[model samples]
Target: MIKYFVMGLRGFFLLAAKIWSFVCYCFKRQARTVIQHQTVRYEVIQLSPLSKHRLSMLKRKTLVLDLDETLIHSHHDGVLKPTVKPGTPPDFVLKVNIDRHPVRFFVHKRPHVDYFLEIVSQWYDLVVFTASMEIYGAAVADKLDNNKGILRRRYYRQHCHLAEGSYTKDLCDICSDLSSIFILDNSPVAYRNYQDNAIPIRSWFSDPTDTALLCLLPMLDALRFCNDVRSVLSRNLHLHRT
Candidate 1:
């Protein structure tokens, strides 16, 4: 009995060490990213009105975004609704007919997504590509865009390539110019074929404090000026570098 107990204790300590190491790594990485974002804040503030116009006039690159967990979380009766402890709340609720049944969905927007969109739209021509079916994805996009025209065009599930039970997005469908286009997605498999042009973000679900979108502004702002987005994205030193 004592031998078994000692063995179990050793295993427990090993597991605890692994967990602690992972936590420390995540904390340190976040600290570094926060410092970088602070530096970018000053640079963003210094830009003049004229500078913005000039930047907008430059050859705008295409920024393809993902929906669902990337920008918003959709919760239906069957889906998991966030406990919604403090600040986060569903932006809107929608009733849609899916396969002859009307379903109500509660959508919670990722924090800072609005400001992030406003800033990135000026720099890059925005496009939304989602793995979800058109019936649902199109409605969500419309609700999020609110007819602002910031989100230029959208591609739905029909456009995705189904491979081995996973839906993979084809970036070429959105833009022929590989150098000028890149995709912002939370799922690695979506961009598995085009890894070089992919910027991975953490999948968000009801976290009111989530700042993945805000933290991305600096790098995205700088990307517009680069000749080829792949050249910069290949470095892959991002907050959620997949």
Candidate 2:
């Protein structure tokens, strides 16, 4: 009777093992079927624009701006700005003492300059490197900044290297990091020292309908992402100047 009982117990264990194996096999087969019929889909999601505080988190490139002819056109009392209207007032007047003589200048801002500065300031740390005198550049810079404090720094004529009777900007004096620095000037000679980093803008001389500054937005926007500005400014600017 004891031997028969042991045989029955062995049979019962075998049957339970078979049932467990069958259950596992069914589960695996069902999973395989589900995977085979699985449908994959992709969707693009749009995000909101970054805030000024958020923009600060990003490592920005340095953009050096030229003062005269590039951003604004200023003429002294001795020379008449041919484009100026008979009765139209200048944007602002600047008077500075030079050589023991006080000189007055009529200043006109380039079209869309305010909007351009507002946008670029968000992407780059703007710096003014003008060939103009310190007293004059500082006053104009103040007008451009308009208390927004967007311009990070300023470099004047004294800071420039005198070359061939012309003042050319040395970007190294402003920022030594060549890879991330850009010089936006109307004059080629100003950026002759750093051709790779130069962004040649048209000479602005009181053209109200001028869209040059606006056209540069797309290029400037695209450049902030690059590790080296020369990689794109040198190659892609020709393709997308429109």
Q: Pick the candidate with the highest lDDT.
A: 1
Which residues of candidate 2, in runs, are more than 4 Å off?
1-58, 80-85, 236-242
Per-residue accuracy of model 2 over 51-80 as CA lDDT, tens digit each: 444545546799999988889988887775
Candidate 1 lDDT over residue span 1-242, tens digit each: 99999999999999999999999999998987676445223145657797777676667789999998899887785655454543445799888898999998888888777778777886778999999988888888888888899875999999999999999999888888888999999998889888789898989987656788888887887787677888988777453343
TM-score of each: 0.74, 0.72
Top-TM-score candidate index: 1
What TM-score should be assigned to candidate 2? 0.72
Angstrom error of the Cα, residue 234, model 1: value is 1.0
